[model samples]
Target: MSRPLDKAGWQAMADTLTARLETRAYIDDRFVDAAGGETFETINPATGEVLARVASCDQADAELAVAHARRAFDGGEWSRLAPTRRKRVLLRLAELMEAHRDELALLDTLDMGKPITSALGDMAGAIGAMRHQAESIDKLYGEVAPTGEEALALVLREPIGVVASIVPWNFPMMMTAWKIAPALAAGNSVILKPSEKSPLSALRLAALAQEAGLPRGVLQVLPGFGHTVGKALALSMDVDCLAFTGSTAVGKQLMQYAGQSNLKRVYLECGGKSPNLVFADCRNLAQVAHHAAEAIFHNQGEVCIAGSRLLVENSVREAFIEHLLAAAESMQPGDPLDPSSFMGAIVDATQHRRILDFIRQGQEEGGRLRAGGEALDGPGLFIQPTVFDGVTEDMTIGREEIFGPVLSVFGFDSEEQAIALANDSVYGLAAGVWSQDVDRIMRVSRRLQSGQVFVNNWAGGDQSVPFGGVKQSGNGRDKSHHSLAEYTELKSVWIALN
Candidate 1:
């Protein structure tokens, strides 16, 4: 394990972030105030301190930004630029991100309470996502359909004008990259609304994008609450699309906002209660146990695709529980700035309390607390890496998305039973099946109802994978070439040439 940054080093990083806050939101390639100079203070969850005062942009500011984006799109300087030119700007943005990786990682850690090591990796992931989309632009080709000799049919993809991206706070920088990269690559104007809880990095990213030669008004950042600014974007008639990543309820509301306004295309990547199934034939129980614990405890279990529900065959239930508990004990929550910390503080006091409420609900409903269930004795917003065994299918913990460091264990007798339990959810975002038997892995993987499945592993994939969910988990996908389609519209044109 690597040593954590010392106190002085952390303080220096904090000072740098504070200086960034002096000029909060980035709109139209400039650091500016909200419409009325309204501002909000974003707190650091790890230290319970004020990290920065960000612009509290609302409907008026959102409208202004949307107008800017609409004008940029209509002007055609950015939206109609050659693919190579757009690609160059995007590559430069990625380069700038790499150059400031350390500062960006530190900003993420202080803003969202993620471990410093994990945050550094997230910065790299963001850079990669940007580069992937940038490099893909020039390779995308239109198609010519086979028509009779008298006629020719062409299928071309065109940008959908102004795109609004409303992202969550859990993976702020990465989520920003996911939406911004594809939208900009497709030659659309973008307005980014970062969650008020963690807006520092997005603000910094907008500034870097401008420095990379993105035309003014082509990309903007609005730092505000979802209910106010998010609603405005969804309700804007001039906006052509809205891409969101958040809760199912909010995603639904955004869809309605689109309907009420211009009927804009809305793409959502929402909630999940993904399952991790372990059969009795698994080759190694210890390795499975270790990864199983990580599937839930990593990122403090704030991931939308976290393996919150663990299903084990009855024959190996006891052994699996033993090893899992041992693994869970090692993932104690610590200071997020520590490079060696496995888990960090919860996002804020509200989220910390919400997780505690779910923990209480788990106990009151009937699940037995096998490992951790209490808050730590500290000033920062911290919670234990909680695990519950003997959890029933109907228990609150088993059915709901806790979005915290809590795991619920259940037992299954047969393959059919495991598949049934896994599919019985409002979400079908992802699932994992662990077994050494190749046939069994294939059989179970085929039966699992999820967008992504992992066999003999958990949460393993790259930016190339098409990621999204089914049922109530929301619609559309993010990442990969598939995501680029979300920001573009297909048109079929037929011409008769004599």
Candidate 2:
């Protein structure tokens, strides 16, 4: 399918795909139902309609999937394959994803209510991650350690047998690809548990993997809730490693589950209330405001690294807010199927209500609502792009991770104060500083306790950069070659030359 030129063309494509959406879980290279025959309806947040009745996998399904993954890994059909052979298979999977880009984009937009345009844009990141990891497979090399004259030491990186990846709903295909591509590229059997809110893309991708020559049981997708299928996978004794991208609370829970089971290795990329700082010395306040609005409102602010907290220099705070309001006007919520829409509905009613509640709390705490503060009328779980000025560091809306299109503005007089405010939150995922002063940028970027810091920009990075968080946000990295470390184990072999 080609790229749709307009809203109608995209809508027509979406209608066609919705009529025949895949709902079955993919296991052992085939689509199947839950062993208990239980099912759950996945709702389209855009229209408040049921898109499909997906298999609601539970402990039994988790156990079955793990057994298959274990067998596949132990059987060496995939885990023992040559790196070049595995690379070819992964590259083929990437090609299939590119061929089916439109279908996969529609599945995510319909399931999670992101704008079709945004959903389509996500495909580049998803496919690029796969291709990058695939190309890196054979290129990765084991290292030799400096040793005494009579001894030779070798340090090797090997796949951790069975990996369970739990991805969130916000960026379904992209997050799934980020977690699984490297794990699969490392020659580990992966069992993916996508958030039940949006599982269509993951299921579809699993089928594509099989068609791309992935061995049976090498890759599986289970569509279900975190407490059941997610918990089961984290606690499975046969599962050697677990990788997750979601809320900080759930990330912590999975860590506990890992400890209770076989002490499996767990890697987490969790939540953030990331801050964006704007100094009076910024080269362009108008440009900074435009990017700042995008920093918080893009994808309905569902981004874990969304710059929800905006700390501006006190001298230019008022002017920046005015420019920010104008930028926010262009991001009003609309139909996800429409290519012209900039913002889409929240993932579900629960998330919609949570965002609204946070807005109300901001008001009650004496924070002034500078722009939108109410949910838009009509169907779907839509909330207008909201901004709250006069937000204090201690305010509820300023400190917590709302994970919505809500921006809390704060004023600081000094660079030290800006750094202090940005690092005050429990999260340290990502941060941004908009200033032309090189010294100030250097000073603030070093002081801010975030995993990634952008100077004179909002959110701009590619697959080559390592991404993750520090403090409570989460541990471990995703993307770049650093990610492969999460899915692999290190072993040392020493040989005596005597």
* TM-score result, candidate 1: 0.98
| TM-scores, each model vs. reference | 0.98, 0.99
Residue 14 error, candidate 1, Å? 2.5
Looking at model 1, residue 4 earns an lDDT score of: 53
lDDT of 1 by residue, 120-185 (tens): 888888999999999988888889999889999999999999999999999999999999999999
Ten residues in sequence with the least summed lDDT for candidate 2? 1-10
For model 2 the local lDDT of residue 79 reads 93
Off by over 4 Å in 1: 1-8
Tens digit per residue, CA lDDT, model 2, 214-270? 999999999999989999999999999999999999999998999999999988899
